[model samples]
Target chain A: MTIEFDAPSRDKLALEEGTSFTPKFDANGLITAVVTDADDNALLMVAHMNAEALMLTLDTGIAHYFSRSRGKIWKKGETSGNLQTVVDVLTDCDQDALLIKVRVAGHDATCHTGRRSCFYRSVRITDGVPRLISIDEHRHFVPSEVYKA
Target chain B: MTIEFDAPSRDKLALEEGTSFTPKFDANGLITAVVTDADDNALLMVAHMNAEALMLTLDTGIAHYFSRSRGKIWKKGETSGNLQTVVDVLTDCDQDALLIKVRVAGHDATCHTGRRSCFYRSVRITDGVPRLISIDEHRHFVPSEVYKA
Candidate 1:
């Protein structure tokens, strides 16, 4: 049987200070997850998690996410061989979001583009027009080669 | 006049590699925003941004978010004097999410609980039940006093 979570407490103080792990899912039963590199604390990727994905991550210590477009549980890095092993899972003040620190296996990458992080570019405004510029050039693996269809 | 974002590209490669700042908002016209400290890169908070909020943040160089609960634009830390000045704004591979690096002013705290980061607790399983534990106990200010109604 899958481990069940307690219903979120109505008591504001108890919800913030208590030990119960009652995550407040959105209307779609999804919660935002922020992923980071465990070693350097680098911001890697942001994904969503449904109840099942959250439970599996908690149970197996492997990172799993809900793919909004695919409408199913995604075993992250399953295709890219960059499986993420959970180092820590943290929740925010209201418990609506999560911060997941992980040690990535295989290519040690977290992005499908083979970059260590999905956020490999930074936004800049030039002549009042915002533009994205690539800042991180290092790729641990080749995406086309790894994600063979 | 607020800056207008370009329409999201139909081409997948262009969407990922293009310089345009076309964000993919969900059906509710909002995108996920992950905030972090500029100095230490600590995960500060996870919020949402509507088009107006995103435009304001980019134009004014200040962090703004859309509060899902309140259904309005939120100038973060406006009431508590913890205003965040954006240092860098980054979009992920698909441009559906954003990673905002900021230098927080005033109390230097992000959470309403007077914590530097909203993610101050870690989840751990005790006897096959997940429980949260207060990991970062450094309160920068007193919440009750700071947020006196």
Candidate 2:
């Protein structure tokens, strides 16, 4: 069965208060997805989802994304074994982006660098130039061994 | 003073571990920004920022964004008197996006609708069709009076 979204209503009130789930995909036919860990609510990653990916995520309760670099639908962590199980899906006031709370499987890592969250670095300005500082150093797995296949 | 970003590095290790912040802006010269409350870390809103806007935000310690629809730099809550003071700024593994923690002034609202957060609705699948349910109903201020200007 295919799940189709209704075209977003032009009326602002209906879009904000209504019960329908009409996501506004951008010109690239993708909507932004903000992922967070369900237990701690820490941001895990940010990605994009096409209609197919959104449908599959909602249908299967598994996170899927549109890989812009690969130009195809990506079942996230399919190769690395870190599949995300959806806990809650939320849409913002404008219904253009998504906030998905998820419980991660496998090594419980969300980033390719084997970190639990993609936001492991904090940006700080030193003498007017922004520098990244590693804030989270705990790596759940070794990337070289996990994706060695 | 002007702030410029170097081109993103092609090497994955250098891009991830390097201290330099070379954000990967899209073809539109924009990067995705995810916002959350500083105290509770509740997802507030998601937006985009151009190089100028990003620099202004970092330089001023105030949340600024690029309005795609208005085609200009937006000082968030400028008219509504709900200015967001930056608490922390973080970049994901790829540096294509930002996660900003902020403290909201005035009504303590981030969304234009006077809600404390943009993610007030939760999407759920019912009978194989996705539906949005209002999870939060607290309105901190009246939108009509706030944006009356």
Candidate 3:
């Protein structure tokens, strides 16, 4: 069965603090999902989820997202062998975004580049010129081997 | 002068490791900025930044965002006293999203609702029905007192 969300209401229960989860999807019918490792507060990936993706993630306790490029639901780590198991899911006050805490399986990586997290570089401006420097230069796997195989 | 990012290149400079910082903004001319407290890794706020906002944040070391609702650039805590001082800014491999490590001033609150972080509620399934449970119920400041002035 699919899950649907009601539009937020004016009722005190729904406005200040609601019993129901009313997600506010954007024009693309998607909401941002900020994922982090449960063991540590390290952020992993930022993705988009449709209502269906959100429902599936909640029901299956696995992370699923909508791939705007492929235009389909993506089960994160399905191709990378870095599946993420949902530990907990939190929503912000406006209910427009989601924060997912998960335990990463396999390589414990979340980036397609095989980095532990997608964030691996720092933007630096030295001598008035902007540049990027790799900070966490650790790769859990080789992307060519993971994606080409 | 305003800053511009080159499109990420296919050359070894970009694909393997590049010095140039090329940010790929979405069709909305915006990039996602994930904020966390510098003192602790506690996620503070997830916001969006246009080129102007991103430039301002980088130049000022203060959090600035593109307010979709107001259709203007927002210097966070402009109205409130909770200013954010960016300690570091990290970019993802794709250079599309940013992770901002910040030191929040004033009440150290990032949420308008008076929470240190905007994500304060966890969604749970009880009796086969979805409900919201307040996980971080601590309010650092009263919203009425903070905003009404």
Candidate 4:
């Protein structure tokens, strides 16, 4: 059976102390999902998940996301072979967002660009100009080689 | 000055290879901001930031977020004295989301619930029932005692 969320209560005490999982999806019927590497606590990638994506992840123990650009349910790493195994899922006090701990399988990469994490660069203001500096420059796999059929 | 976004290009090569900050905000002019502790890389909070909030965060070196419920620019910790000092801000490949690394001030709490982070509960399914478990149970401060003043 697909998972269903209880109706969110507006009362502060009930909302925080309640036992129901009432995710506050936005107007687009999407909730934010923040992913982190289970081993190192490094922020991996942030994505959106509809009810189907969330339910699938819960049911299958794999990461499923909703791709706004693709306008379809995304079984992450379905094409890249870098599937993510959900270790644990945590919801915030208000149940508006989720923190998903994952063990990334296959090349240990999460970014389509082959980076270990999507946040590979550090934004810096150097010499009064903003520039993106590559921090985690190690690519787990070459995108041209991976995404190619 | 408010931050302006570069036009989002659909060309995969250009979007990934280009060196401009072009965030494709949703119809609400909001981008998802995922925060992590600068010291430990632990996921701290997830919030939405308007262009004004983002520019102010960059310009002031402090975390500012747009409160959708309050419908205004929220200078974080303005009422709670828990100002977050921005350590670094990183944008993803397509620049639709942001990763903000910050060092929290005051009681080192980022959650209104007197917790270090808004995420304090782990969701699990046991015995065919979903339940919430308190994971980060350490309360750095008492919310009722702190927010009362």
Candidate 5:
């Protein structure tokens, strides 16, 4: 016998009006948005997606986000060709944040600076002092086409 | 006029007896732990530190973690030289988990296998299919000699 995987219906995906998504803030008081992949398992990106962006994400299949530095709404992969295709959206127990699982298309890089994501840097302590581990220039992969204006 | 930074007294450094340092889990079921550097201001790693490992971290400066894969206590830098130098610990509003901002030390890499941290991989969606951006090989740093043995 053969089995098939059926996609969830739209009605099943319909969330309670005004009670679908929420964002959680950490100790630093910064809102955290946990995004996952389509299978509902793999975490994609941990970026902040605000209320407006959340609504836009729901309205459109593409993921919309608020860039902390740019201070504006950024459609994922708009310039980099690394667009996020929204599959499912969820929230933590608290109705303050959202968990969006998306499928990325076009370019594999998600960060504007040419890295796959914004969280490429790692913080380390040496000699009892905090320091950032520097990435070797040769090992770094930044697509030039994305950064070109 | 002049100003100076005075070191903390031994008494000041000690936690009050009977005062638990563990974090309180939030309504969202997320745990928070804080690891401060020597100066005690800037955050290092914002990782989800669980109960068992949290206790281990308190017991020993060498961080012990709950391996999502092995599902057991994993001592930080045990296999990899990227050890987390745990400094001060803190909790969130609810006090369930932790925001472990450790001073990462030893080899620049932290991931058990050889990446900078465990989160070097990025998930993306292409044509409604979830995919991973394979950038783990680009991680240049390797574990130090001590842990390699």
Candidate 6:
């Protein structure tokens, strides 16, 4: 069912107070969004969610976010179809952020550019020079035909 | 060159104070990490960075994080090799968080599960029920085979 935004609820107020159960948000009015595996607490991904997006997430039980690039509301899997089914939404002690636990639908792939998570690359130092660790293969998810402009 | 995390020099402290930069750490002693674009202003991801991972990131210019599950430092590309190269490290106003801006190396793929980002799913309301919006194809990255074993 659609959950309405309760701007004055005890839960929301408690979050505003920075109580022990609130999530923390940054100065830009965005909360740190984290997704974890429910069974083992394995971190799935880290993202950002704004108030509108958070409200949408609460209402729809699907993840929604504000895209910095397009500067608009982004619905996950809109282009790809791999969706995150929300199991629960958690807030840290500060109430300005959230930890969203979800069960990934279809495949485990959540990234758009075609990795598991957005953080695929590793940084390494060699002889005082920093370089990217290389991987063996490259995969593409959406065919070039799909988003052909 | 090898950058040292020496105690902030007087000038450094002055600059830090002038900029109101403060680093935040979680209960696990990990800094609150924020990912931004190349300009270092557009926020991309909000995650955590432990001391070891932060040091490694600084030394190697690749993003490293403490995987709460694996209970060790995880280099971004250890498996898939889509790496985030460190461009700059920034602190927030309260000295309780950090902003890490990086240049994604290799492919545009950043997510682990083969999406452009880790936030590929969306929450939508269907028939008055919160439902996940699904996408069609899967591309790019491979699943974590080791985790299944």
Q: What's the lDDT for all of these models?
A: 0.92, 0.93, 0.84, 0.85, 0.47, 0.55
Considering the two chains of model 4, state its CAPRI-style docking category.
Answer: medium
State the lDDT at B87 in candidate 2: 97
Model 2 C-alpha lDDT per residue in residues B1-149, reported as the tens digit of each score = 55678899999888898898999999999999999888887889999999999999999999999999999999998998899999999998889999999999988988888888999999988787889999888999999988775
Q: Give one digit per residue, the lDDT tens place, for model 5 in A108-128.
A: 545444544333333333443
lDDT of 4 by residue, B1-149 (tens): 44555667788656665665666687899999999899999888899998889878888899999999899999999878899999999988777889999999999999998889988888787654557778777888888877774
Off by over 4 Å in 4: A126-129, B1-4
TM-score of chain B of 6: 0.69
lDDT of 4 by residue, A1-149 (tens): 55766667888777676666677787798989999999899988999898889889888899999998899999999988899999999888788899989999999999999998888776776544456677777889998888887
Docking quality tier of model 6: incorrect
True contacts kept of 4: 0.52
Ranking by TM-score: 2, 1, 4, 3, 6, 5
Which one wins on TM-score? Answer: 2
CAPRI-style quality class for the chain A–B interface of candidate 5: incorrect
Candidate 1 lDDT, B1-149, residue by residue in tens: 45888889999999888889899999999999999998889999999999999999999999999998899999999988999999999999999999999999998999998888999999998777889999988889998898887
Query: What are the RMSD figures for all models against the true structure?
Result: 1.2, 1.1, 2.1, 1.8, 15.5, 15.1
Worst lDDT run of 10 residues, candidate 5 chain B, spans: B1-10
By lDDT rank, best first, the candidates go 2, 1, 4, 3, 6, 5
Tens-place lDDT digits, model 6, residues A1-149: 44433332356434422212222345566676766555554444566787778778777777887765577777776666667778876543224445677776654556554544444343344565433332212434643533455
lDDT of 3 by residue, B20-137 (tens): 8877788899998999887767888888999889888887788899988788999999777899998998887667788999998898899988988988888887655667888887
Compute the lDDT for candidate 6.
0.55
Better of 4 and 5 by lDDT: 4
Candidate scoring better on lDDT of 3 and 6: 3
**What is the lDDT for B15 in model 1?**
88
* Candidate 6: residue A13 Cα off by (Å): 14
Query: Mind sharing the TM-score for model 2?
Result: 0.97
Please give, for residues B62-96, the per-residue lDDT of candidate 6 as tens digits: 88988665788888766666678888664432234
Using Cα atoms, each model's DockQ against the true complex is 0.77, 0.79, 0.65, 0.58, 0.04, 0.05
What value of lDDT does candidate 3 attain over all alpha carbons? 0.84
